[model samples]
Target chain A: MNRIACIISYDGTNFSGYQVQPNKRTVQLEIEQALKRVHKGQEVSVTASGRTDAGVHAKGQVIHFDSPFRIPAAQWPKALNACLPDDIRVLSARYAEKDFHARYHTTGKEYRYRVLNAEDPDVFRRHHSAHVSYALDIDKMRQAAAYLIGTHDFSAFCAANTSVIDKVRTLYAVDINVHEDELHFILRGNGFLYNMVRIIVGTLLEVGYGKRTAQSVDTALRTCKRDDAGKTAPPQGLYLWSVQYND
Target chain B: MNRIACIISYDGTNFSGYQVQPNKRTVQLEIEQALKRVHKGQEVSVTASGRTDAGVHAKGQVIHFDSPFRIPAAQWPKALNACLPDDIRVLSARYAEKDFHARYHTTGKEYRYRVLNAEDPDVFRRHHSAHVSYALDIDKMRQAAAYLIGTHDFSAFCAANTSVIDKVRTLYAVDINVHEDELHFILRGNGFLYNMVRIIVGTLLEVGYGKRTAQSVDTALRTCKRDDAGKTAPPQGLYLWSVQYND
Candidate 1:
């Protein structure tokens, strides 16, 4: 028996989410259906690195599944793609070592948020990004982001629904890039709490729009209060860019 | 009454086509419905720069309509966008000079065709582009394109369904750009025949696959026969990029 890991990408436009739901269309259910076909009528289950919210895209999501039959790892992508929907694609597949886990063995993760900061609507980017009509001060947002980097108790950036208690998380980097009329936020962290990235983005946007300051972000982190941060940004603009695992 | 010109963009995935059809959702019908609402439930019609096939997108499609009531040019877009669907957006609106026409006065047009030449599927671009599994020779396609440029009687490129008699059209440029795993073809001409751009693209794709040569395209033009060219490409890959007008 072997654990096989594969990298997959999805558009997320029409999906309920990455999780399996009874009656809803989801990325997991679609892939699982394809896996069932590949296993010749035997039901198969797949575990992903994490669950992306509804309408959140993924560029390189990692998943692992136990195979009922022997198959080459390199051919997994092609075989799975044949059975999968066009919106979901397997990019690469590889054999994992014994005791390998897709979620528990992860070392870090990276997420990106795209914002279209323009007056006129861009037809091409309607689904891929969140539109902000008001101009943003990207440099100011960068200044506020500096205080969020490194280890800290990020209770202010987390949503209220999760049952997890441990609030300490190490953020490696928080970078913002401005292109034409778009602002992209690339975040790297050891682990994120529920709604952490979106809340952080919403807070940073306050700084961009002159509603908050870098010092305010530092205070928000020190206070460990959720209300200290800005509103949670929409999930549509967020993407699970890539995942990191131990070598 | 004043002539109003507006630039609109659309996804075109759910639209039947640019023109009106019975019992079908179309770009024109949507806009006309929106226009009717803005005019207090009075029916209104709009003339477009040209008609695009079903499933074909647009970046800068122009439309002109005569106003029944006086409204500021800058206000038209905001008014219409409120009633338009999410797939369609009014980019800009302005008052047109006396007798300014969207279709008849157009000087030239530009069309773009996108092709994803890769084994791996690009989930994000699945709707906006055509996917080809085989590798393409861009240089060979470019060579074939060179023969198609300039003024020529393009009877071989027109669709068999069109009733237009004159086949002479000026091709200003034909550019093929390769980016990573995608190939983009941009074509500019004084005017286009029904399905002319798709036919040209199909012929160029044959050249890229080594099935046809540059000389074959030259002979097809000289022969002035529809059967001399290749098959018409699919509409999903094509976009009405822009329409040139005399300022």
Candidate 2:
């Protein structure tokens, strides 16, 4: 059996996120169903790098599945895209080694959180971005993000429900960029706990808004208590940009 | 009394055009309802630039409503946008002259039709564009479009149900530009009869595919018969771009 890797993009608006939930629609379940239709009526199971919450979109989410059928690698992308729903698309497909796992083999990951920084609410992008009406000092946000990089206990930036015993995680990079109407938080990390990225973004946003200082990030990182961190931004603004692998 | 004008943009995927209909939801009716709520229990009526068929979208569609209660012109754009549904947005608003009419005072109009010219469909833009997998010659289409410009009898390109007696119309410009996977057909005209723009685009697309020659456009214009033109393209790809007035 050959391991097939697929790069996917999804709107995630109508989905219950990337995981398969019983009796609920999800991006992973839809992909599996489409694979079944394309693979001669055989039910297929797929494993992804990570599961995103509902309403969280993706650009380069990776997944892998083992199949008995032999099909051209070039045809797999089109065939899967045709069978998949309009909100989800298989961008690329390739054959990989048997030991290649989408989740376990990941070396790092990148995520972006978009906040629509505007006075008036954006009606069209309401579902795709979080609207922040208050003015923010992006320079301060950038300064605060500098403190977030490197290995530290991220329990303060994680959700209360996270079951991980080790709160230490290595953040490779964090950058904040501001456009006319958007503020983007791009983060690269070895691994992220539940809502860690969003919480970090929220804390940085508070610093940008003058509610907290640039040292607030260091304070949150040092203290492994969840209550010391800022709130989690909405899931709609969060996107799993890409998963890294050691080639 | 105030004559309020509003510029609106809509994603027509879920709308039944911009006009009111019995038992049908329309952009006009939705805005009117929102106005009624703002008018302190007074029912209101709205007039738009023209009627767009169901599923057609607009970016610069204009409308006017007569109101006894005055709303600040600067604030009206936000007021209506806030109360209106997510699919429709009021881009701008101004108080118009008492005799100003959105349809009658229009000096010229612009329309654009988008065709996705790629083998693989774009899932995110599926609702806003028409998918055409076949190869198209942009030069051929542009050459064919030249013949359709200027004043001529456009009955061949008009829909069968069009009630206009004079089918003669002047097309100021017909541009066919292709960028990567998208083809934009931007047409500027004094006015368009029902399905005129779509039929012209369809005929030009046929010319691009070598199914018809560039000379066929002139022949169709001279013939003044509906059979001489190609089929009407889908409404989803059509956008009422802007309406111009001489003031």
Candidate 1 ranges beyond 4 A from true positions? none
lDDT of 2: 0.88
Question: Who wins the TM-score comparison?
Answer: 1
Fnat for model 1 comes to 0.75
Against the true structure, whose DockQ is highest?
Answer: 1
lDDT of 1 by residue, A101-193 (tens): 989999999999999999876777878898888778878888899999999999999998888899999999999988778899999999999
Runs of candidate 2 exceeding 4 Å displacement: A39-41, A115-124, A133-136, A177-184, A225-228, B134-136, B177-181
lDDT of 1 at B12: 83
Weakest ten-residue segment in model 1 chain A by summed lDDT:
A66-75
Q: Please state what fraction of the native interface contacts candidate 2 reproduces.
A: 0.39
Candidate 2 — which pairs collide?
A: none
